[model samples]
Target: MGRRRTVHKKLPAHMHRKGNSYYFVQMVDGRRSWVPLGNDLAIARLKWAELTNIGDAEVEDITFAVAVARYRRDALPAKAAKTQEEYDRALDRLLAVFGKMPLDLIIPQYVRKYLDERKAKVAGNREKAVLSTVFNHAREWGYTKAANPCAGVKGNTETGRLRYIEDQELLAVLDHACRPLRDAMEIAYYTGQRPSDVLKLKRTDIREGTLFFRQKKTGTALRFAIDGPLFDVLLRITTDPIQIPAGAVRSLYLIQNEEGQQLGYRALNYRFNKACKAAGIPDFQFRDIRGKAGTDTEDVTGLGHAQRLLGHKNRKMTEHYIKERLGYRVAPTPKLLIKQKKRA
Candidate 1:
């Protein structure tokens, strides 16, 4: 019913060339749907057969690119902004390797090979996780009938961060921090909250002599009594004179820039890194402050106190988090044993 293409006349029925690329044309719901079969004629022919073979009609055939597009449309919107950014980065790497491959053809061996070849082992693990999710969604969408290929694959080994900021290191870094950075650091250190939680704090979060925190990552709600160092930090934030930039209203967030805008992640990271560089403490990160709080709390009080401060669900997790920072000390000398032996 359509005009025969004069150019690429040698192309098979239902196949057409547009620019440099080939397409497989099918009528779906009475409208022509053009599925991309890529640019190479030989590979396009192979993909065309995969799509149109009578024996394979029962199983939906689509490339990983198509499936990823569908996934980005349907799934990525539901994730948090930070998580979406992480997945987007992973997806870019995954698409380069498997984009043209048929979704059902992506086997476990291929997944393993990709992981082995990737130079960034830790980042490869994250990309593998994103690929696994794509396969899962592909199955649900009927694009593939096979089980997810990434299920049994073991990712590269990764160790937890073990750096601890000493008291002098903290003081040095604090000396170089700006007003907003100082406030953010003290809040993070005293409350033992994540950087995200610290930035999200507002005047409304404090009520009736207690500061409340609802962790963004874990949804763990914590309440800290307003006392001691935490109390001093909060008082400073409240009593300090804030210089608002022209045409910018005061921010609802506790941490704000000179412009009176809520401190964003990029700004916060830049300022913290600059301060660290100035202090000559390049190894220290803003996150290590939380660990310091936990370690110091455990030393002064006990493990339970540390667990509560860090908002960990259990003491075991708290122990693992603080163990590296709890540098070894000689066990108390056996004075009681000596006394018992003397009496005997």
Candidate 2:
């Protein structure tokens, strides 16, 4: 007679029950394993169906490794490269923390605990945002039915402590900086453009005494009319040509050092901060100089004009720059403010 069949023989490829509530599925290869399906019976059933349809004649024998390979091949390519990178990183972190916990056993509370632990180690709202996005993607791809644990997690609020140099501080810092850093800082301060845009600036971008280029971050075309002081600075740095790898150098915004290499934004930032410290100007961030410059331009050109120069998506952001730098007060006009009637 044939040997009596055991329960383990029926569900052979590492199946486990969780609290009499759900099923967990894993595929193991000796010691290594993966939880390919977790949480709900419906989702587990669907994944099983998918596995069988894919020619896994014995769905009961499907391994976690196979499920992981299939999921990555089918689901990962659908996401953007940057997004995929973030998801991969998050998964790495998850695996480090949970290390092959059965998928069905990963309750919402387990995820919440993981997040709380990570929150202490990861320093920034960005990490939290990335985690939230990954969990959302996992749910959308049918990896889990549980709502994203990160949904209600609060992100750290960025406190805006404007580290803007006043006119006198700017003058002092610039006077002490080396020529390359000074020029770069001046352009950032004068134009209110991002460091990336300022670094990529070229001579050809300047036409009719105005610097014109589409901002790299926002793709908004900005035009800043060059004036006497800015022109003087440009004239001081205009010298020896830089050989381009592909095409001819088109712009003169990035002045090379004596070594003839372009000044990277990182180097520029470090040198700029050093100059600020030497000048005894505390809290003078590179970006604050841009705000100061924008505030100055708002008087020359209207706030709307300054808004475009700074490449702000809207006037509201531009207004914040103006208010912080110029101390421009916004109170309701007498015409709009309600006044008390004369006392009887």
Candidate 3:
């Protein structure tokens, strides 16, 4: 697509004509800095006027920290709760570097310095992304007119770092995992659901043979047939007399603590990590089980079914799992059934 400059036929409210050209009498540095609106009043009135309308008074004192706070209160809530938390954490790291700087003063050079000093590239990249959003919001709010500093910055590659949980790793984790942790992992792997989602699964979500709920992150209503591992495990948990504790009420959740409370991520991680150590397994995350579910049965059920299983909005996410975690499967070399003749 070709870029087209927009033009507004009429001049804006603050703009006035000086000699042959239009100019804006707006505040800058606590005074009116006569900004040249340009000879073509139409284009200047459309493109520049919309993204930035900050007066000099607003620009004089607006700092990066102030912009971040506004973004936190106003723009952050639209994201998922988990995503909001992650972005907030990344924003804190950015604030540490440029909290005192004015919004317009934070240029690409300063951002590049921050990226270079940071050892963890993925986290740094996320911080850059969050800062970019903050600046964009600031522009819309008429706080600053600077371009997004994160526009051209590239994040470090995290390829080949993620690996799927092998069957042995599963056995090890299960052997040492508490009942709640074990149930969480099992459900996550079997259903190809996020561990976060699995941790919140309630017993009431099951009806007949189908489990249904709206996923927290995506808000997509999910319905999965409860069969195979999911069915067998849930049946045992509900029907087995020994599995139920004496005098304890059956929990409302499928994967809750002994007190029927939803399991916290920190507590689950600690227990899962301890179990992994006990089983002499390497550092494989429980979340990696999601990737295993995508590839393990996909050869038979196909990618579409696997995509649905993972609750991915698209197949691209599922494909990333198959390639990043599983890598490509090596096909068998062809062989001749009969003896080959001597080369001609």
The candidate maximizing TM-score is 1
- Give the whole-model CA lDDT for all candidates, comma-separated: 0.85, 0.62, 0.75
Q: What TM-score against the true fold does each predicted structure earn?
A: 0.78, 0.60, 0.75
lDDT of 1 by residue, 8-40 (tens): 755556889999999999999999999999997
Candidate 3 lDDT over residue span 1-344, tens digit each: 42232553233345667777777666778888777767753444443344243333366699887677666546676677688779867877877788889998999888888888889977887788888889999999888888888888776565545676778778877998888788788888788777778877777889878988677878888888888787887886566522545677756677767665677888888888888888888577877787888888676688788888877889888777676766676777688578878998
Give the local distance difference test score of model 2. Answer: 0.62
> At residue 212, what lDDT does model 2 achieve?
83
lDDT of candidate 3 at residue 69, scale 0 to 100: 60
Off by over 4 Å in 3: 1-57, 240-251, 330-344
List residue ranges in candidate 1 displaced over 4 A: 1-59, 327-344
User: Worst ten-residue run, lDDT, model 1?
Assistant: 52-61
Query: How many clashes in each structure?
Result: 0, 7, 3
The alpha-carbon lDDT assigned to residue 6 of candidate 2 equals: 61
Better of 1 and 2 by TM-score: 1
Ranking by TM-score: 1, 3, 2
Q: Candidate 2, residues 1-344: lDDT per residue as tens digits?
A: 43444643322234444454324344466553444555643345345546545334243433323333344445655665555665555544554554344333445566556556654544435555544554555455555565665666565446655655567988999888987787788778767877777877777877887878787756798776778777766666665344445544444456554455667767888888888899998678777777777788887778998887788989999888687655764576658466679899
